[model samples]
Target chain A: MTIKGVLFDLDDTLYDSTTFVDRARKEAIKMMIDAGLNATEEEAYNILQRIIKQKGSNYGHHFDDLVKAIEGQYNPKIVTMGIITYHNVKFALLRPYPDTIKTLIELKKMRLKLGVVTDGITVKQWEKLIRLGIADFFDEVVTSEEYGLGKPNIEFYRYALKKMNLKGEEVVYVGDRMDNDIIPASKVGMHTIRILRGKYKDMKGKCKYEVKSLREVVDIVKKLIEEGV
Target chain B: MTIKGVLFDLDDTLYDSTTFVDRARKEAIKMMIDAGLNATEEEAYNILQRIIKQKGSNYGHHFDDLVKAIEGQYNPKIVTMGIITYHNVKFALLRPYPDTIKTLIELKKMRLKLGVVTDGITVKQWEKLIRLGIADFFDEVVTSEEYGLGKPNIEFYRYALKKMNLKGEEVVYVGDRMDNDIIPASKVGMHTIRILRGKYKDMKGKCKYEVKSLREVVDIVKKLIEEGV
Candidate 1:
């Protein structure tokens, strides 16, 4: 409907956080081993990734805790581990999928307010936004670290709508997660666009729209914007 | 109710996050003015707090964004602003109410599995648990940030039960927010306890049980745990 604003997700929607995280996890494991941990890189990587998968982000495992568990103490080792892991995984490898830039640029030209609603760590996520050089492209960025709440929680969606100064019906939320992203945004009356590329291999739901890639966002929004429904 | 597990909320239920957040907001405003932003500490505090209140925690004019806005670029000034604000607010002022620690210890002594089901940011929240020296008290922490979901969404409660390796009937979920906490826990087949500590004065609902303090939790569960039905 009028389409005053557009909200997008960061990881797995625009850029591939999985690859960056995988690389980071590998480096972290190496750092742990270098710091005298008995576990192999694969073992540490598996444990870290498992934590993220279960807890949503590996950073939840405080670097200090891991350092203590691995090194028997918390000291510069934790900092080194965090820094090394961060450098390895930090947005350098976060290649936005083909057509993401063009889609965002096109959306900007259409004068639609842009925002990001991501369930990501604070510092790392913002760093990615800046590094991608897409920081200014968004009118606002709503990260879970800042929100104290995350997706699938109506509070988060409501916050984004209020920040964008748009009602649920006036904005469209595009994301990849059916359980976390799509359902919550849709429940708040915001139209949802599910990106098909990420984890959803057999996603089925009541989404307002779906696209195979970020490139299709423009066309989908254009058509939906024209409908004014 | 063989109280297999007891889940507590971090902010305002076990500890008052509002007080901590208020302190942090005030400190952040001071930092902003000290850095020569046009806004006073009071004004800046009001603005930041307003953003959280009107927009929700994950929405609008984040501390980093605010620092960037004032400095006219991305700088550590914004990062430091948030760090200091959250630190002063949370670290200095956040404290559990009377008997909070005692109650938790008692529950632990009774061999009740303790967990935390909170709609709060994972990083800072886990920090709070550690700061309060109560991190070890919980068997699991189902933070919204970590879970990618929050209360009022039944899945969050269901996940908590799963983590506890107990059915909904086997555990009791407790929190302050009626809409976001108690009712949703009830819908998932978990018995609920509503703590009306006046923090959630606006909270309204018909919950299974209500108490003024967490001290009541032990008694409530003690009675319910004995009745099989």
Candidate 2:
């Protein structure tokens, strides 16, 4: 069990994605209210929140739904206002947790190869890394969209291991979701670290390690490497 | 199935609780950052959000945990600042959805008994109704704490129906959580309407009806009453 590489999840693993999205969407709702949708700011906010809850956080037609719900039709002006406000607020606020950079640096210093294996569009995942200023820390970054495969697929984990020039048992995969990160990685004989955060925190899964923060991963990696794993 | 009374859940059923809590918690984190916490505002915000996610929304010692996570000790001043900011922001923003009052009024006009059967402390749930200005709309309000019981407990549904002088089959129970509202009511022979909102929206459960808005409940009640249920 000579651990060579440590992989991570992006959203909710290294950053405060829930807070960022909540703030961004709330600001977007305010912009919609100011644009004369004939509702109070809170009413507009609730409507948008409801639509997001129903559709999901990444749904592209949020503004379209917002306009229809508030004004009974799609007003491009209002939709544009909302989209601009949401993106502006979200991008401005996107940042890694305080311990993220320090922990990554510490892991890198331990001579363990670091990489990110995320499930998202290629550009969006790369943008997140660049925005957080941690793009250089990874030896490799694999996004399912770019790889033409998604997580829970053992092939994706195998691909990441191959890119790192390491065997499955020699790398540790860390992610927030059990189904996406832990189960498949474990299936491939890779030691899995389930970071207890994000949407799937409550989901049950199999993993060799479970930690509350990325900072905790440093200690676990150190122990495993010291013990020849 | 003739409906004599309609019952509803409080949080997220009558109001947008997810948005409400997110706004309040973020404001509280900001207050923590400003009040001599060593971390940046984003760091403080992330720490608090993580703790909330781990401990749950109703965990009583959130401020204690926030202070411990940021400052490494329990400082009453920081705790007080966080608590005051969180409560002020939450109380100021608490209000029902735009259609809540209108729908309640419409149901009243239909000459049907209306009530709220919720699981929470007595004063808190009552305060929400009062703050939303819909306290007078309900002929009866039952809190699990007041009744010495909680939801999914058949006794709770039985109590609300008994208070309204109605049989179980003559009442319709609407709630956001299927476990708390739909299943138990259904078990008691009450027609259940699961409002597709809140934390439990995606959960599977048995119910006689499902709706996206409180306003939709008015139509459901009208049809049921007209059909002589």
Candidate 3:
């Protein structure tokens, strides 16, 4: 099939979400201390990180759960401080990787349908695109919120294929995860490119392409078109 | 007396606090709405900006007051969201002006004491210097919190002079405000230079000198030493 479209995972594929998130989290802890939290910055951050690890980043109410864990009950002052600090810093520091914009621009010149298939809150994923100043670049955005299902679900990848009105073999799927993003999309019969960065960089994943940066995605797409892969 | 030191204001003079604070405020309002505030971004920002104006930026409870004013009573969820959102964005966006570092470095090479004197919470002011990575450049940081007194008060200027162990005439004071910074320091017999930027950019202030940027301060100090003024 001829390659004519590209689908992307928002977080690690387009941007280095890990480093900024780390700085924002630390700043949040410092601000929590400033907001009358009883615990030290180190103690509070360690506990929060533990909770995030256990509950996952999107379980909702991480701060709400964190304050209860720390103080043995819900404390409005403490919980609010953590919530405000974490998100404000998070969004303020939001940015795409250096190569993301140029890569996207180059892909657009290829006359391809560009879309985002992300597992995150609908508004927040949209907020990420908007803040990164790349919202207008995409033709469609498919979030887990819209389907009430997320990655690793074979149907989710199929749904994105349908949204772009293209067959799986006609497009390339690029993301940074093995279990949920790469493997599942590969099963859906799409050309899958796993960006070897972020949390899953060390995890070995079998895919059509294992590249280090977004810039390479453009060339792969060009080669696929020329070779009719 | 020969000039031997320089004292500066923390905000406007040392950095372009206005631009960053404005961006951070707008981002805070956007995040607040995401956190479940009922108002639109424009409405929330307008109300918050008004509150900051009325109570002044240093008012400790702007978010708490905003929640009360908006919902007609205290709502912990909404209030906490605003509080966490505003502060997190504010601190994340903190930055120094482009010329601030080079000017400080040049002045340090000339062996000036290089101190900061102005108003606001001591800890918060210290946080600014630290976040901007310019804390080591200053020999002293005198905030209103130290003496429970702020600018426009001649005694505060005198206190800064005493701390540096130099007569008022032997030091140069650089600040953006005419009333609180320039006039008082001038009254105390110091050389005063007003940076023509920030809220006071257009206001005509009578001082020993006025300049468009911090870069000019280095030249002024050089001239002072050469002519022994």
Candidate 4:
């Protein structure tokens, strides 16, 4: 299996997304308290946490709910302030794992094609890559927003394979999700590598390879190359 | 395992939640189009679908995003109207599956205790039961909001067992989600039944029983009672 191209999931695969989100959430809570949320810091923080658990992490109205809960009315300005603070803190804190850049650089040295096949808004995905200073390492970046497809859809994987001008067997897809990354990639005959972290870590699925960190991916790629896989 | 109690998850377990949500979404899109947004019905529908996929079903600001995308500004009144229309349609369409009430009535005849162990806001969960006209069928109703716990947590399952005054083995727990319901109920020593509907139908997990509908649960409970489980 001569792996010609390597694709990755952006959020948790290249960076510690959970930690970043947690830290940013705490910061946002503090900002909310400071911005006349009418609650003690601890009270506001707990209120936000409760809202997150109830409405889920992706819930866009959490800030609105928080304001309404504490102040008995929806305040757009407060919600906007909270969202801005949250994203600003999150982006400011976003950094790739220490081995991420080095591993990508090493893989690039092998003349292997690298790409990112991630499910996210185009601008946000690109921003993360640029912020991490690894945008130049990849030959292609396919985001769901731009590609008109998302993970678990084999077309999403095929798009990257097509762009790299490589067959599925000639590519390796690495991500933290089983259903979204490993299963779909494997179905397309691409080698799938499961990174054991993030929300989907406990999700059960079959894959060709598993690794704990990006550093370990370099070793797997080297082994694959040596075996002509 | 003398099945003295039967616990159920609400939502898809009792009714076709997917169908309800789909209908409600279509109605909401219609409402959005009629409320001065500049788009055709089809365009509005697609926008809502895209927003749902991008931000997730639980996203609190989907209407805000939809209005901003189509109208170039966020109008709180429009978002509120969208939400009101969506929920109104959903609740109006909320009806239990045909077999749901009959199955519960039959199960109740056997002198076994009935309870609802659900994860959602207290008012919402109760509203579903009340709307289904099955509120009195349960001897107990334990929701995550009031109980301070959610599914897959052993504590959440244990709370139901305690309330029923029965050991885990004496209870038969049925739900749609393998990770959130079956696994945790099994962990707590309850007889687990996976109702095969909902987003998690394909999730892999170990359970003592699997069924297609609430009607099948009555049969399982009867068998358990006969076998003195």
The 10-residue segment with the lowest total lDDT in model 2 chain B: B75-84
Interface RMSD of each: 8.7, 18.2, 11.5, 15.5
Candidate 2, B150-211: lDDT as tens digits: 88899988888888889988988888987777888888888778888877789976566888
RMSD after Cα superposition, model 3? 13.1
Model 3 Cα lDDT, one tens digit per residue, B19-132:
878887777667667756778888777888889989988898787677677768754445545555556677777778899999999999999999999688765676677668
lDDT of 3 by residue, A100-143 (tens): 99999999999999999998866567667766888768887888
DockQ of structure 1: 0.02
Candidate 1 docking category?
incorrect
Which portions of model 2 show Cα errors greater than 4 Å? A1-229, B40-56
Candidate 3 residue pairs that clash: A84-B84
For residues B1-229, write the lDDT of model 4, one tens digit per residue: 4788888888798888888988887887776666567888788888888988998665667877998998998654355557767877987898988889999999889988999998776555765776677877988888786679777789988988998899999989889988888888888988988988866788887566888777888888888788876
Q: Estimate each model's TM-score.
A: 0.51, 0.48, 0.52, 0.48
Window of ten residues with lowest summed lDDT in model 4 chain A: A75-84
Best-fitting candidate, scored by lDDT: 3
Judge candidate 1 at residue B133 and give its lDDT.
Answer: 68
